[model samples]
Target: MTARTAALAIAMAAALATVAGCGRKAPLDTPYQAAVDARKEAERNKEPLPPEPEKPVADKRFILDGLID
Candidate 1:
């Protein structure tokens, strides 16, 4: 094939590949989209996820109010 024709074909292929790639969204596109969706679903169901951690328990044993040691 002529050099000019070959160059044109290569250029067209590259352009087509670039255009094709533009339509794909990476799994992590929004990063937190999955978390947001899960939160919405949990809110709708009025249920907390099992793996969620609870706040630390406060110490109620007793503490000296005004001790200096």
Candidate 2:
């Protein structure tokens, strides 16, 4: 291959290697790991999950009369 093409290929390979190395998950995976740890902790503590709140029923007449306004 030509010298210019060889140099370009080397540069591209180096750039790809740098990006691949930079993409390591040790730093970015902390939050997910923490979440998993927290879930396990909650399970260990035998904490029950909170109940869902009840939604209010809409008053159709009040809405039509603009009483909500």
Candidate 3:
């Protein structure tokens, strides 16, 4: 094969590798809710637990405070 074709192939492979490595993972679960659930489950099992998380700031906003969800 020509050197030009070889270089092209290598460059393409490098770009593909970079793209694959850059894959971003999104959070699959809500941390606040998860914490709340954990606390509840722990209490149910007779284990001592800290107070549950308070309502999120976003939920306490007024209608005119910000854009609609």
Cα RMSDs of all predictions?
Answer: 15.0, 13.3, 6.4
**lDDT (10s digit) by residue, model 2, range 1-69:** 999999999999999999888754764645445666666777799986334334456545654576545
* Prediction 2 global C-alpha lDDT: 0.69
Model 2 spans > 4 angstroms off = 27-69
**How displaced is residue 59 in candidate 2, in Å?**
41
List of clashing residue pairs for candidate 2: none
Best by lDDT: 3
TM-scores of the models, in the order given: 0.35, 0.37, 0.40
Residue 46 alpha-carbon offset, candidate 3, angstroms:
0.3
TM-score for predicted model 3 compared with the true structure: 0.40
lDDT of each: 0.70, 0.69, 0.84
Candidate that scores best on TM-score? 3
In candidate 1 the C-alpha lDDT for residue 57 amounts to 60
Ten consecutive residues with minimal summed lDDT in candidate 1?
Answer: 50-59
Query: After best superposition, candidate 2 residue 12: deviation in angstroms?
Result: 0.3
